[model samples]
Target chain A: MNAMLDAAWAVFVRELRLALRRPAEATQPLVFYCVLALLFPLGLAAQDVGLRAFAPAIVWVSALLAALLGIERLFRADVDDGTLEQWLLADVPFPMLVGAKLAAQWLLIAAPLIVAAPLIALALNLQPQAIGVLLLGLLFGTPVLVFSGGFAAALTVGAPRAGLLIPILVLPMMCPALIFGAGAVRAAQVGLSVEGPLYFLAAMMVLSLTLLPWAAAGALRNALE
Target chain B: MSGLSKRQKRMAAVLVLVLGVGGAAFLGFTAFSKNMMYFYTPSDLLAGAAKEGATLQLGGLVEKGSLRREDGLKIVFVMADCEKQMPVRYEGILPDLFREGQGVVATGKLGIDPVTGERTFVASQILAKHDENYMPPQVAASLKTADGKHSCAPFKSLGRPAENLAGKPMTAAAEAPRS
Candidate 1:
């Protein structure tokens, strides 16, 4: 068990190091998220009330797109360097290694988005309670998004034009997360019980956590073959 | 055969796949259907399809000559989707773009009139087309005729009355003194 954990840790560190080396790649999505969030107010010319009403949808959609911007490269670097096949051959389990890599990707790509969420929410004129719920929704929803995107990324690692394929394959699967995430904020805005959508988002996170890494590992093996 | 039969291993994998995918789909579908709403026309509401007090969006053209101000900041108007009309009551200032014959979407609950028991939409928010060239997509789609042509029938019969300028009609464009 210790050996498996150590191996997972090693993979996590290695992936994080690689990401840190490419500062531009790591920061591009965050920049995209901020720019997109700012564009809504200017483009729509919405009043404070209208901005408040649509803030949840704006934030959630921008986050989803920003996450997508980085996900196509999740497995590409490892696959190109042949590190993926080495991991498969190592004594540590493949799924554990995959899970570790996904964790690192989530931290790099989605965690900052969560931290910056308040600024975006405030800029869009969201209420304090609604901002809290929006944060919670992102807390649960972003992981599911990363996992789903990672699975799709793993599947297409060996395919040509993976950049084009990833969004087409992943966007449909992401609809439920988007709906529930935005719905939670809207519910809180209207003083409705946010637990319903938040619970659904939590359930999605659980489902993704259990299933995606194994599926991604299987896809990696297929790609390596 | 090996310790575990190959067929048995395949069966186990298939079982897990089915349970996982099926369960997730079931949960996702139920949550989505429960929360997502399609914009309903007045005819749909009039047919009693919408349950009383259920929160949803209603889309139509604002009926001409039907807008009336009851009290300070309380306005009532009839909305028609060409086939039928429903009365809507809203409190607070309407959007600048809100006007007769323009497309609008009112989000609120369908309430029963206390005395008449007729269904009326009590709007919590009134959203009109943002500009002259832009129409809310749902409102535009709701107004499309069966033959795929855009129909302005809802506004055609209700002739364009004199522009209501600050709650009064301006008799002629030239009558106003140059600013």
Candidate 2:
């Protein structure tokens, strides 16, 4: 167990190091998130009331797309460097390594978006309670987004135009997270109980966390072969 | 011979794929179906399709000359999809963009008049669209006619009249009858 954890830690650090080295890649999704969020008010010519009404949906969609932006490369670098083959041969559990990679992706890519969500929510005129719910929703939802996206990324690691394929494959699976995430904020805005949607989002995260890494490891093995 | 035949391995792989995909789809669909409460048009209400007293969304344009104000912040208006109309009662400060002939979505329960048996939407929250150029996509989709055209064509094609209504005092008691 200790060895498995150490291997996973090493993989996590290596992935983070690669991500930090390419500063543009790390920051591109955050920039995309901000730009798309700001564009809603401009495109709608909406009043403050209107902006507030749609803020939850807009923020959720932007987060979904932004998380998607970096997903295609999740397994590509490791596969290209033949590290995937080495991991397959290693004594440490393969799924733990994949989980570490996904954890790193979520930390580096989705965490910033969750942190910056309040600023964008404020710009969209969301209520304080609603903004809080948005933050919680993102905290729970982004991991599911990363896991589902990572699965798609792994599945298409050997395929051509993986960047395009990842979104097409992952977006449909992302519907539950988007709905629950946005729904929680909307519920809070309208003085309804947000617990229902928040619980649902939490369930989705748990489900994805339990299932995705193993599926991704299986896909990576297929790609390596 | 191998520990497990290639055919057995292939069958096991297919079984896992089916179960995983099927289970995910089942869970997703069940959740979606449970939460898929959609906006009902006035016609749908009139058709008796909407459940009585269940909280749901009603989307349409506020009818001209149907808005009224009662004592203690109570406001009443008629929401129309051009073909059918339903009365809505709300007791709150409406969004600034709310006006006659403009699109709005009201979230509430369906109630029937005790005497007249008229279906009324008792709104808990009212959401008006942002501007003249924008309409909620759900409202737009619901308002589409049989010919794939908007049933609320006058509001869209006759842009001047819609703009004129925007300037009207949406919450003013003036010209608003007591109910």
Candidate 3:
């Protein structure tokens, strides 16, 4: 148990270290999210009320797109360098390592977006109460996005033009997360109970966190073969 | 290093997967049972699904001819789920697609009507929900009564004249001045 944890921790640290070396790539998704948030108000030319009404959807969509932005490179880089097969052969469990790597990547990508979400929400004129739900929703929803996206990325790791394939494959799977995450914000905005959607999002996160990593590891093995 | 065989490792993964999914399913199902109705129908509202002053969504078709324009922007209409009907009071510019005998979802709190002492939904926002099978009101009216007379039709005569805002450009924001 200790060895499995230690191996997973090592993989997690390695992912973070590798990401730190490419600062621009690491920050691109967050930059995309912020810029997308900025474009909505200008594009709509809407009044405060109209803007507020559209705020939840705009932020949630931006978060979804931004998460997509960072997903394609998830497994492709390791597959390209041939490190993925070596990790598979290691004594520590492959799924644990995959989970750790996904966790690190999620921390690098989704965590910053969660931090920046309030600023985007504020800019989009979201209510303070709804902003809280937006944050909470993002906290639960983004992990589902990352995990499912990582699984999609794994499926197409060594395939040609996998970038386009990733989104096409992953976006449909991501619809529930988008719905529940945005629904929670919309419900909170309208003073309706957010528990239903929020709990659904939490359940989705749990399912993805458990199931996708194992599936992703299997896909990685397939890619190597 | 705590050495484990490959089969044991796979077993542990399966166990974790099963346990995790089981736990999540439990939570999701419980939440679904608790809040299966995302929006309350008029029948659900009448059955005491929500308390007075509690915020919720009321979904139904706007009863034809039951719409009456009151002082200022206030409009009173009956929202019927084809089974039961509830009176709704809203003060704002309605959505463009908001018309009589169409699906509309109103979000607001339930309150006691001062005059009637009956429960009324005081809506803060109104969203018109329409599907691709767009039918003229006459077509819809005929189709609705095809399966025998709908009890909801009695309130049709009680409706006062509603201002036809078609072709007039209106702001999406109710209180926003026309620019």
DockQ, structure candidate 1? 0.06
* Cα lDDT listed for each candidate: 0.76, 0.77, 0.79
Candidate 3 residue spans exceeding 4 A from truth = B36-38, B43-85, B88-179
Write one digit per residue (lDDT tens) for candidate 3, span B1-179: 54878788888877998999998998797557444355677776777656676678788778778999989999999888645789999999899989886678899989987767888999999998764455577765555532222222222111111133322211222321212
Tell me the tens digit of each residue's lDDT in model 2 across A1-225.
Answer: 465668889999998898899898789999999999999999877575678878999999999999888677777778888898898987666777899999999999899999999999989888887888999989989999999999999999899787777778998879989988998788678664566577667767767876898899999898888
Whole-model alpha-carbon lDDT for candidate 1: 0.76
Q: Model 1 chain A, poorest ten-residue lDDT window?
A: A187-196
Docking class of 2: incorrect
Ranking by TM-score: 3, 1, 2
Candidate 1 vs candidate 2: the TM-score winner is: 1
Clashes of 2: 0
Task: Please give the lDDT score at residue B54 for candidate 2.
Answer: 54
Residue B64 in model 2: lDDT = 72
TM-score of each: 0.62, 0.61, 0.73
lDDT of 1 at B1: 14
